[model samples]
Target: MSTVLTHVTDELQSIFDRARSVAVLTGAGISAESGVPTFRGGGDSEIWTWRGRPVTELSSAELIATDPQLVWEWFDYRRGMLTSVEPNAGHRALAEWERRFEDFTLVTQNIDDLHRAAGSLNVLELHGNIWRARCLRCASTFEARESPLEENPPRCLACNGPARPDVVLFGELLPDGVFERAEEAAARADLFFVIGTSAVVYPAAGLPITAKRRGARIIEVNPEMTDISFIADVTLLGKAGELLPQFLKERG
Candidate 1:
């Protein structure tokens, strides 16, 4: 192993040995390795660029309310994409860590269900899940195992009203309870691992900083430098699939 990897391995082992409570934050980078497309960069834009809009634009509240069919079409495409992909090694490593740790929280920004599919529990999806839907009228929620509604936009069985993906669309507030739980986890973490994310998105981006302020040691694992890299206690420069397993092996 290179000198940097050796240093990271030693640091990670130290953290794992000492930490009683841990919090992990993941982003599109983790899912991208599993065949899920990311929202930025060349490859990402090529796949999603046909829409001629940013991800935020496609998921805006105005778009969902004014042109529901268009939104559904976009969601349908994403759903199909997610169905074809599977969880990667990085996901499995995190899930394994969850089983080993007495107190751990896996916070993910990706809407893909790969984290859950990899057998991770105590996951907090900061964005939302693609497999869930909620009524626009009554807010009744349901899990769509096989796309329960046939209508383009779908409708709630209870109120027979329009239903949208349960994700946090642009301009829409995050689910109240979920944000609170994520904040609590961040605040209480003794060791915080930021994986695959650039730490650019608001509120969610503040999580690592929050944990840092509370005296949590922040470790960043990514191939590229992120906004939080300077503040991180250790910056492990590598793909998460490669680095996480190494760190876990050291822990074992």
Candidate 2:
């Protein structure tokens, strides 16, 4: 192994051996490798040329209330994108880690459901999944089906009113119960890993720092340097799918 990998391997082994609790945060880059399109710009046709819409415009709470149809159309497009993709090697590695480590927590920002698809059991999705919908009236949540809705917007079975994706939209607060659990996990972690994220998104971005403040060793695995890299005790600069397997091998 090269110098960087050698250092990272040693650091990870040391952390895993000592840590009773571990937390892992993942981002879009990990899913991108699994054939999901990057949110760089418009539709697939203008992949490289077009600029993408802001998250706020696409997910504003106001937009969902005032123009539910528009928001639903946007979600439909996103759903199509997600449906075409599958979990990659990195996702599987995390799932395997969860199986091996009894106290490991897998936290993700993406709403693609790839982590669950890869067999991860203990996951906290900071942003909600697109595959699930929630009733705006009764708060009942259910898995979205492939069939078309009869109305412009789908109605909830419980309340017979409009239902929206369970995801945390722009201008909407994060799910109350989920973040609390993630924070607790971070605070108790002895080892924390940040993978595939830019570490720019708030609240979620603060998770690693929370663990760091509590004396947990931080490791970053990414192909490019991000804001969190400076805080990481060891930085493994490579694709997560490739790096994770190698790191685990070194541990063995």
Best by lDDT: 1
- Residue 66, model 2: lDDT of 90
Residue 25 lDDT (model 1): 92
Q: How many residue pairs clash in each candidate?
A: 0, 0
Worst 10 residues of 2 by lDDT: 42-51
Q: Stretches of candidate 2 above 4 Å error?
A: 1-8, 40-55, 147-151, 250-252
TM-score of 2: 0.88
Q: Clashing residue pairs, candidate 2?
A: none
The residue-by-residue lDDT of candidate 1 on 1-252, one tens digit each, is: 112342355656876767889999998888888878876652443364437777667878998989888887788878877777888889999999898778899998888889999999778988888888889899998876564236867878789888888898989787778777888889999999899988788888989989999999888888877788878888888788887877566334
- Writing each residue's lDDT as its tens digit, candidate 2 over 1-252 gives 112442345656766767789899998888877877666422243233222656457677987889887777777776777776789889998998887776899899989899999999878989898877899889998887553444547778788888988898878889878988998999999889998887688898999999999999888888776788778877788888888876467434
Number of the top TM-score candidate: 1
TM, every model: 0.91, 0.88
Report each candidate's C-alpha RMSD, comma-separated, in the order given.
2.9, 3.5
